[model samples]
Target: MADIATLFVAEGPAAFGVDSYQWVSLAMLVLIGVFIWKKVPGMITGGLDDKIAQIKQQLDEAKALRAEAETLREEYASKIAGAQKDAEKMMEGARREADAILAKAEADSEAMVARRQRMAEDKIAAAERDAVDNVRASAANAAAAASRSIIAEKHDAEADRALADKVISSI
Candidate 1:
């Protein structure tokens, strides 16, 4: 116990008065905390303000882009409508032309049919007339042959001459 006391005495005031060092350490910690508290909020607020300004600028750009997109959409819609109208008009024109062509073809066909029918009728009438003339000539030839045979068998020369004259006059 005496040796322990001697060692304690040798350690001196620093060992006996540790409360003062503890107080100094506590005071330094408080001073550092106070310095951080005083300065950190201003720095954080300034950085947040810069970030907010950047966000607002980005939002404005996005709004402008949206407006441009809307304008483009409207313009394209009108163009599409105009193109549709043009296509419809073109189709209508084509249909009308086709109808006209069909009507012309029908008229030409009818005219051709009528001409063919008229030609056929005329040919038929001419053939009928030729047949009647041929039959009449054959009948006359037969009658003349019979008369010549009868005359040669029984009639005199004067009778043959008179018959010939009558045949010529009738013809």
Candidate 2:
């Protein structure tokens, strides 16, 4: 319901004119058509899909590695615990052996001391016996010398002849 002059101006541009808004509109439409014809949207969707798949795979691998690490940690912890128990057992054995060795050494030392003491006592007893024997011998010798002197001073040959006659008669 508009006049021809107003419609022409509102329609944006004359078809034959180079300087017009219509030309820009046509170029934008053609660019959009080209993009659609080339499947650009499909290419973008495929790329995004591939990236999602890669990320999911990486996540799964990370989960698996984490599980393996946990298992390894548990294994090493158990091994360390076992090793500690073994070490403690070894230490106990060493202590027991050391105590036994010390006790044996002490016993042996005491035995040696006792043997030496017995040997010293035996030596002292032997010395005492020898001393008593020597004293007895010296006493007997002194008594014999005194008797000889007494007989030589008090008794002459007559006393000896009398003692001989008395012994002959008694026999």
Candidate 3:
């Protein structure tokens, strides 16, 4: 009874008649043998390799998408720059046209003013000529009237007949 009681409480087997540690070791060995026979390690490693390949494929796709996005961004940027340049050129052209229009309008207005001034000067000259002609005509009419009155007052019928007889005797 004492020997059986000591065996139950003993830390190790004094002489090997299988102990609890031996039973646990035997169970671990059987489990390892089953895993090997089923090729569980190979299956686990293969699944992990497939997962790694899938992740690599996703990374490659992401890289390609990023590259395409970068290309599109650059293309749009260049188009925007070109559009801005075209807008600036159009604005410059419009400014030049406006300046030309303004200059032409100013020149036309000046020409019109000069033409109107010339027309007014011609009208004034014509009026002055008409006034001088009217003054000359009035003077000529007054002189003729004075000469007729003098001739009628200074001459008579008797003096006119004596001058006629003397002219006839000499002939």
Candidate with top lDDT is: 2
Better structure of 1 and 2 per TM-score: 2
Candidate 1 positional error at 103, Å: 1.6
Q: In model 1, which range of ten residues has the least summed lDDT?
A: 8-17
lDDT of 1 at 23: 66
lDDT of 2 by residue, 1-171 (tens): 468778766554577785467788889999989988999888899999999999999999999999999999999999999999999999999999999999999999999999999999999999999999999999999999999999899999999999999999999
TM-score of each: 0.56, 0.68, 0.60
> Against the hidden true structure, what lDDT does model 1 obtain?
0.89
Q: Pairing residues by index, what is the TM-score of model 3?
A: 0.60
Q: Which stretch of 10 consecutive residues in model 2 shows the poorest summed lDDT?
A: 10-19
Clashes of each: 0, 0, 0
Candidate 3 yields a Cα-based lDDT of 0.91
RMSD of each: 9.0, 5.7, 7.3
Q: List residue ranges in candidate 1 displaced over 4 A.
A: 1-39, 140-171
Q: lDDT of all the models against the reference?
A: 0.89, 0.93, 0.91
Model 3, position 43: C-alpha lDDT score: 92
Q: Residues 14-65, candidate 3, lDDT per residue (tens digit)?
A: 3368787778898899999999999999999999999999999999999999
